[model samples]
Target chain A: MTVAAQSEVQVDNAEVRVTEWRLPPGAATGPHRHGMDYVIVPVADGEMTIVAPDGARAKAQLKTGKSYFRKAGVEHDVLNETATEIVFLEVELKV
Target chain B: MTVAAQSEVQVDNAEVRVTEWRLPPGAATGPHRHGMDYVIVPVADGEMTIVAPDGARAKAQLKTGKSYFRKAGVEHDVLNETATEIVFLEVELKV
Candidate 1:
């Protein structure tokens, strides 16, 4: 069994829900789907392994302080394959 | 005269807009209003000086990797009063 990443809800309000996710080496977020539009802000430069529902896998390179936005209905399992810990903040829009 | 902070638009889509703001010492974002609900992810531990329209000033403490959300229609000028530069990612949700 793979170790799951740790997530903490930093803020939840009418506007948005912000969650901080910390992934140790070899940790994964497991398969999940996003219910709302979201933005991701990486805390450091790292790479993430994205596994799609159809078993397709891809590598995503994240830059520190860089943010990206995505629409709703994204399904994937994010894994940290690096030796260093990876941290990021996910902001979900509550519209 | 206060130096203006540098802003780079990272992403813009139907759901959200992501911008990275960099503030050097004594720099400010100038007076601006947020039209959409937003979240801010700090790049490092620092303090920001928020100046309201009426000249009221307040200090906002920011922790690295921590994110906070706010509603729309907020008006303020954000400044970096520390010696080191401060950086953050702002995600605006277009509802």
Candidate 2:
């Protein structure tokens, strides 16, 4: 099977934005929502726990070298449930 | 004082994906474009140089905690112009 790749086009007028997350062991990011559409990429792997807005809690093992996208509007808090430091990247389209 | 925040909505059927990059000093990831829309977040800072498809090269100091958005169709190559290790995150909505 062939792997899909990144897109190629001339996009305009969009500003660049980035966010860094440094989570300590068992620390939570608190409750938050995606104000703008953003992408999440993990540069480091840490056991993560995500709590949905409706109080649904989920835990999963996140690894580096993968990508995930959260919509422009979603409520959740991500916690680095591991004993080691967790780092990730969040990119957003600045309006 | 007011700061715009992340959005909140119940999105469906989108998958989570991630990719990692480990580049040596003066190393390059080759020429490629974004196949899907994605966000870029810098979790770590290093001197980065980006080259657009039209032979346009831009060098900027990328720090952790800033976000940027590249459309689904843009071809660019990013490099760490510094001697230090650089790390970042990319998130994309999987169709």
Candidate 3:
């Protein structure tokens, strides 16, 4: 699979880590399980396709100025569904 | 001073806490010190005045789609300087 997605760690500390994720059209973060509770802040308006661990698929409409949070152990694959680039800020808390 | 600033806890858990802050023109977060490391993602473009503990002051120009992080123990007063409302997402690490 072509790696059209990129992430940059803006902050890394003992308590939490902040990562900026950028994805072009048709890019994805692949399937992964979260080890820590995290929050996502969408930087740009777009849509994303989320593939769940049980093969469930859903569409997440991205809205700027809004954020979402989920607990650890959640598994999913996030794919960009728009024609433009998608960007967001991810903050993971490590207690 | 008018309390034109408001904050809502979007996520609170053992590892991390996420808060969304909104400030109107001339609003301020008051003089405070951070107890945990945190990251800030600006949702709206605006300028802010930061007043330090020792009476030092500086201007922070907000840019959309950009984020910043700082360690704990940082003290400052944040004031909105623009005519519009200023909103940002803050993620705090509890560890």
Candidate 4:
């Protein structure tokens, strides 16, 4: 599929979709892709690994109240390195 | 109105809307309010004025690639202090 199915809701004229996937400790989202630009933010505070398309990756301890941006066609993956559930907020631009 | 009319575009399983309003130099968004949480980011780099509901205000020279988040029900206004258009991106949580 070009894109995976997501859950969304409407806010006024704007629509916000949230993808909440559970991952075990030391689990990963594996290699995936997107069709549009997206913003990555963690809902549940934890440590994560973001693997870039160029085989480069970075480890980030995500904060619950902070957010970062991602561009379109930027391939990446994430991993939960903590012993608890790692809930991340991925807000992709639905355009 | 509970919420104002807005324009939206859909991405793959996500949506991203570009609210490109041309503001005159020193123009403001007025004393407006919001229902949900929101993230504030500028698309076009320029000067802006953000006035909070508490009668306090601050002048922010916005960057095109940075973003900030605001909680729900925070009343604020923005102004463009530049001769050119001051474009900004506001992504509100739909839930």
Task: Please tell me which predicted candidate would have the highest lDDT against the true structure.
Answer: 1
The C-alpha interface RMSD of every prediction is: 0.9, 7.7, 1.7, 10.5
Tell me how candidate 1 scores on lDDT.
Answer: 0.89
Q: Per-residue lDDT of A3-89 in model 3, one digit per residue for the tens?
A: 568999987877677788998998999899999888899988989889998989999888886788888899999998779788888
- Ranking of predictions according to TM-score: 1, 3, 2, 4
Q: List the candidate 4 regions with Cα displacement exceeding 4 Å.
A: A1-16, B1-90, B93-95
Task: Give the DockQ (2 decimals) of all models.
Answer: 0.87, 0.15, 0.60, 0.04
List model 4 lDDT by residue over A1-95, tens digit each. Answer: 11222323222224334344556677777778876566654445777778887889798887553456566777778666668766554555553
Best model per DockQ: 1
Docking class of 2: incorrect
Q: Which residue runs of candidate 3 sit more than 4 Å off their true CA positions?
A: A1-3, B1-3
Candidate 2, residue B49: Cα displacement in angstroms equals 8.7
Off by over 4 Å in 1: none
Q: What is the alpha-carbon lDDT for the whole of candidate 2? A: 0.60
| Model 2 spans > 4 angstroms off | A1-14, B1-95
Order the numbered candidates by DockQ, best leading: 1, 3, 2, 4
Angstrom error of the Cα, residue B94, model 1: value is 1.3
Per-candidate clash tally: 0, 37, 0, 7
